[model samples]
Target: MTSAVTGRRRLMGAGLGAVAAALAGCSGRSGPVPRLRLATGPQGGPYNAFGRALARAVAESGGRLEVVPVATAASVDNLRRLDEGSVDLALSMADAAEDAALGREPFARRAPVTALARVYVNYTHLLVPAAGPARSVADLAGRPLAAGAAGSGVQVLAGRLLGAAGLTGGPAPADERQLGLAESAAALRAGTVDAVFWSGGVPTPALTDLARELPLRFLPLDGYAGALRERYGPVYTAVTLPAGAYGLTGPVGTIGVGNYLLAREDVAVSPAGELLRVLFDRRRDLLREVTAGVRLEPRFAISTGAVPLHPGAAAYYRSVYG
Candidate 1:
């Protein structure tokens, strides 16, 4: 078999061993392995890939857990699913999670979501044609722009950025188009869209692919960070995108929001603890599959602002540190 096939077989072997152990662990008081549904994002997206990797790790850790990765519209949708009790675990943007907790727009009322960990940072990316007319987000006014999908976290952030530029309603002369990441990239390349606003981890594979096809520019969002922070909350932070990241000419400045791994408040503590343990224990395997998984550091994981930590997550942290 090929190396790729060999690796998968090895992983499966580990997972089976873990399942056997899990059965043994459940022989006494706790009945059986916990089955959980994890809501991830669209296919080929960071959240989706992250969720799959996590599921694999949980299966390989000899833990009594069954993690099901469900593909959805990302942050906003994930939160909704968790709230409606369709899923037990989810990955969401800090801003959306905060909004859900506060019963803000897009959410009808408060949600019972609690944080498991702050996993990574999603940087705001304002991609424009290298030879296009727009120099900044403001310049895109009156131009064709592709925001994220309508109900997506991208749309939420895109609206906020547009508002920051003082281009609300008819003030901004732009045709706002809402599209998914891949579609947005395609539209930009086809000259159908002037700009695309994407919030994701650095070196996003899709953007990297688009850059190779056409010259592109990274417009900075640093200027509006303060305004966004003041208006939104502590979730927005100014961050520097290093030079050569995505083959950019120099370091670019942008706003970043923490990405959180969340669970419903009612989730069983033991299962949640086991899931967290499996994540850290099989870090090497997960990292091999996703670069974003590197952000799953223990110290950083506990800093989920505004969102309360799940009891099981707290127990796991205590077990590791104390």
Candidate 2:
């Protein structure tokens, strides 16, 4: 009986030890997840809206992500941050992405950044005071124009468009006032600026408000659209703003480019995949959250040409759309 009792105690001890070991292993191992930092544009830009939606989706998907609002100059700044590893993810324009990847335009050297997906298209809007003499892109010569903030994607594109129209340098050269959207609107109202160049999604609050309060004219870029595409390649395409998009008097012809999400090459594939999955899974929710994100679709997401897609993102795309 004594021997039997001793054996039973030994058996109990071994079983308890095994259970504890199993529990320890379970505790030691954790699901593969990574914390990510997403870089967005200025406080009130379309990029901010997109970033917020992406953050909410990642949170819902049980991934650790923190969207960091960055006051950048748009696409150019986004690429620079990705190249230096300062940001794990960023929002960029497709044209700028191409330029950075190919070491063209502002990029002195090729940047090592890849795309997660293209998000939406941004239209180039040329807004003028209703009573201003600048009836078209050509009328702006020798007038003051808000070309967007310095070092911004808007400024780069605005400069190119102005140059192509032969309105950059002349006897009465158009002066570019480097200002944010809000400031630009104010300048136009005060008659300090004759016209403003903006590249963004429709229903822009500042421009919309300006149109509602005062008479505004949106100059058509009809003749120069083909020329811009020829010079800038396929990244630029002709886009039209419908009559009611911003309470405009009529439809306006413009040139536009796509927006894309970017990530560094070093980020893990799993987390990237998870990020893309969350974004697409809750696509409707995101669209309701922000009007700009409403246009995000699987077809547009895979249409990037400037920067290569992240492997994880590509996998997610293939899984859903394939």
Candidate 3:
């Protein structure tokens, strides 16, 4: 009888031990796990789509990544947020990154940020009404133009291009409106603005939508493309918009800059490395989610000129491409 009792006790003890082990596992005593917060651009833009795709990829990779969509002025503001440690990851333009890193132009001092990867090129789109008198950058001298938003990279580059063409601001200063791309598009369609400058990827949804509803023309920047490239070095490159890319009658020659994924200098190396690996490893899946992801290739990932690479990101690049 004692032997029978001992056998039953042992079975109960074994059951209890198994339950205790399961409870311990549920308690999550496993080491510290890092979570990432990725910052992306305004609604209905390439950055937003890309951010969502990346967040999904990270989640599937067993990493905790939260995507934060910010209604920002785009690259310039993104870089500022990165420097201030307001975000872990951000999308930025090479032009804005170069300027911020070097403490030139809009940035009063050097910013604390580094690039993870150069994802794609953004075209400098000078969209005007189909019947507008301004056919080229030079003709926009005294016209009412919306040069994107105040703190946006688009504004920075638009201002530069305008200044280069001797068209810095409207003849009557009050006539110029520095607004966000979405707002500028709306204002243009309402006939409240004569023209607007948008530096973005091809098939930008907003621009495409506008093209469908209204007759539009993209003013070719060919004349000044060489000069801009020479002045800006690798930060600016000659890009061409294929015919019908934006429903244009013909291909438009323009200057462009690469868009990169950036991060704060202090972000954890491990998580950053994991984030980059997920981005590149699942590039095809991301592209299926958004066409902009097609540009997120290994070849262009480290194409930034002088912008320091995040050590974690650099490590991943060297591992794969080295």
Top-scoring candidate (TM-score): 1
Candidate 2 lDDT over residue span 36-113, tens digit each: 778777767777767876786776765544345565766778888888888888888787888887888788998887
For model 2, the superposed segments whose C-alpha errors exceed 4 Å read 1-33, 64-67, 287-294
Question: Weakest 10 consecutive residues, lDDT, candidate 3?
Answer: 19-28
Between candidates 2 and 3, the one scoring higher on TM-score is 2
Please state the error at residue 76 of candidate 2 in Å.
Answer: 1.2
Query: How do the residues 1-322 of candidate 1 rate in per-residue lDDT, one tens digit apiece?
Result: 4442353233334443344443333324466678999999998888889999898877776667889999999999999999999999999989999899778888999999988878778888998989977788878877889989765788888888898886666666667898999999999999999999898877787888899988989998999999988987878999987788778879999999888999999997778777877777765556444443245666788776667777666656655564
Ranking by TM-score, best first? 1, 2, 3
TM-score of 3: 0.84
Q: Which ten-residue region of model 1 has the weakest summed lDDT?
A: 4-13
Predicted structure 1, TM vs. truth:
0.88
Better of 2 and 3 by lDDT: 2
- Model 3: CA > 4 A from native: 1-30, 64-71, 169-175, 287-294
Residue 222, candidate 3: how far off, in angstroms?
Answer: 3.0
Candidate with the greatest lDDT versus the true structure: 1
Can you give the TM-score per candidate against the true fold?
0.88, 0.86, 0.84
lDDT for each residue of candidate 3 in 120-188, tens digit (9 for 90 to 100): 778888888998887887776666788877777788788778767866554533245788878999999
Winner by TM-score between candidate 3 and candidate 1: 1
